[model samples]
Target: MRILKKILIVLVIIIAIPLIVALFVQKDYAVEREIVINQPNEEVFDYVKYLKNQDNYSKWAMMDPDMKKTYKGTDGTVGFVSAWDSDNEEVGKGEQEIVKIDEGRRIDFELRFYEPFESTEPAYMTTEEVSNDQTRVAWGFSGHMDYPMNLMFLFMDFEEMIGDDLQTGLENLKSELEE
Candidate 1:
């Protein structure tokens, strides 16, 4: 009976440690990447405002070329939604809706992911004039995990993972716009 009690205590402590650690771990994560595109701010904003254009520059959009895509409302305007489905685990299934637009400056999107995992996050892109023909484009994404799930942040480098994809997309965007 004493041995059984000690075994139970050891197991409880092992599990409790993680839970205790989770309480202090951050729940929210945000990542941003930027690039310089050889295009005017208006021109860059115009292209990014249209979510459909992402197919040409977004790394995830190009992940599965055959992924099914659907759209709603008018592109480049508020309330437009671009949804994609793919058999690839990395691509999974998700819908991104244009929540707001700041004319030639920025566009905000709400991303709802369904398959693989469920999450609703916010993403945005901003264009600023660097020179008469140069535009600085910034892409950002932020999400929050609940409770113990936030503990994953300790082990997972969400910033690096998501930032890499954002940087790749921005680099692709720069190439597409420059060409």
Candidate 2:
């Protein structure tokens, strides 16, 4: 009986210590990936401006290939919104609004997820002319996870999960833009 009590206490401490440590450890999770496309900046930027074009470039990373999408307001302009719902947890349910557009340079948006968690984050894509015929496209997302989520990240690899997806999405985008 004494041995059993000792073992239980040791197991509880092993689990509880990590949870306590995680609560104090605050870190921001970010992923960035860039792809060089064999196309001009204007050509690539124009394609990404529209929510409809997301279907073409996003197939590789989409949580749900058949997820329902609806566009609100203008299609390619700032203030345009894209909302989606999917059974896949990776994609979840979210709406993105075009927060800013700099012609062929950058597009910034706000992403809000309904399921999984009720939170919003900033997401954006940028394009720069590497040369006359090639353009560099970069996509990145940054968000903060508090308390238990920060601890969850200790076991979960945010980069491995999301970074590869970003790379795949960029490759798909490159293919579409070059085509």
lDDT (C-alpha, whole model) for all candidates? 0.96, 0.84
Estimate, for each residue in 20-52, the C-alpha lDDT of model 1 and write its tens digit.
Answer: 999999999999999999988988998999999
Top model number, TM-score = 1
Which regions of candidate 2 fall more than 4 Å away from where they truly are? 1-16, 59-62
* Candidate 1 backbone collisions, by pair: none
The TM-score measured for candidate 2 stands at: 0.87
Per-residue lDDT over 38-123 for candidate 2, one digit per residue giving the tens place of the 0 to 100 score = 98888888888786787777743365777878889998898999998888887778898999998899999898889867889888
